[model samples]
Target: MKTKPNVLPAHNDCPQTTTTGNSRRRKAHRGIEMLSAMGWWSYAIIIVVCVLGMLFGLYIFGRSGSEASNLTQLATATQRAARTQAGFGTANLNTVLYNAGQIPNGWTYSSGTIYNQWNGTVTVTGKTSYFTITDTGIPSSECISIAQTLAAGGVANYLTVGGTKITPASDIATINTACGNANSSVNSTTKTIVMYVGALQ
Candidate 1:
């Protein structure tokens, strides 16, 4: 018998090992490109958002500060015009009335003598959006000047005096309507005269 043919490893019997190095490298490159593109877009978007937010904040802050400053100035002007330096007992009503001007609200002045009412006193009081000059026995004519001052100060509603409601009109007409033709007596009958003035809220 002839010698057995030389035994050689069969092609299908040996473990098959396939190399995927090229495919893996290609996939990795694609993934890296996608990640890089996403990172660049995200960074750009973040920067834009931050810049817009800062600009908006600055605008709001500036507007608020301006409004606050305007209010403060208004308040100061009102206080300066309304408050009197004269004390309660030593106040001169004529002088006070003469010096009165258009002023904001929240002012009061108490004086011992207001009209020729024999030691009668008066109180000029201001509410949140209105002002009142009150006296037990003062002539209604005294309110003319005061009303004019109030009007110049920005009062728009109807003014009242001596238990009468006076509708606003022209400067002269308003004064005439407010004071009227009737004259009140300075007697002990407690005839309170109140001059009401409307103010901005």
Candidate 2:
């Protein structure tokens, strides 16, 4: 009776309260850690997407450059063949040129057919004083870019994008207009480019 002097039963609830508080704090900490992990994952995903986009862009740029180079090589070789070969104006100009080793490196030629970087058909047709180089399956934008560059450089006497003729003297506006016309086709996202380069003297 003397020991029970209103000691309040030793307050067993104090230990329970302390344990509950610690548990809540641990849950909050775990939540914070989970949020932090999610944020990191989001950032990682964004970085990966950006890297993939850049790589795709680079691939497109490199492919365009290669196409341009290939076209240039074909033009140069045609000019040289025109100057040296007596049969330059034949109906089978591509075969004749390829037989003479006029085809550019890396181009696939078999049975008189030439394939471009895009696996498109590349054909060479001849006239008396000029020859035509036609490449098919070009992307619309790349077709525009290549046509503009060749026109600006005065490399081709005349060229056609989607069958719209453009000359070396064609202004940027004119070229853009021609390309726009070709790009308006809903049936196809690709185009054909035909270049007419005069035979070298």
Candidate 3:
């Protein structure tokens, strides 16, 4: 009698092995899909954050621009009022400027008091030779920006940022330091800009 020859069984004969292999492949596919979904979510989140940052930056820029324009208008109006009165002469010029239609439009004016873009008090006071425009509740960045602009334009004889006087020679670094100091002071959230313009030439 001849011995039977040894041979391997067909793959279909092992059901358990086939099932295990299929299960492993399925699991790996599912894992790849999950990872792809997470990557897309992360990308979307980054886009949203960037868009929000841009919007916030735009809001700040617009606010600062409006404040600077309003301040410049007020200063010009004050000069006009002073010339009409022949001199500033220690008088409060708010009412005079408002009555003359000199105050900028959209400014909140009540009881001879005008409010700035930030709803802070804006006062116009006069000395013998020059008038002062004092605006409170300005943010530190805007304070520096407006001060530097006016100083460059040669409009203001002198100005103060948070009570720190800024001269023509004051550089950006100096202004930044002054604003930083003011913002860290008692009025931590806001600062003040006081601009002095000459009266009658």
Choose the strongest candidate by TM-score.
Answer: 2
lDDT of each: 0.47, 0.77, 0.81
Question: Model 2, residue 199: displacement in angstroms?
Answer: 5.9
Q: How accurate is candidate 2 locally (lDDT)?
A: 0.77
Please report the candidate that would top lDDT against the real structure. Answer: 3
Off by over 4 Å in 1: 1-20, 76-201
* TM-score per candidate, chains pooled: 0.29, 0.81, 0.80
* Runs with alpha carbons beyond 4 Å of true place in candidate 2: 1-17, 85-87, 169-173, 180-187, 199-201
Give the winner by TM-score: 2 or 3.
2
**Candidate 1 backbone collisions, by pair:** none
In order of TM-score, best first, we have 2, 3, 1
Relative to the true structure, candidate 1 reaches a TM of: 0.29
lDDT of 3 by residue, 75-178 (tens): 88777655545578787888888888888865888998998877898999887788888888887756777777767767788888877888889999878876
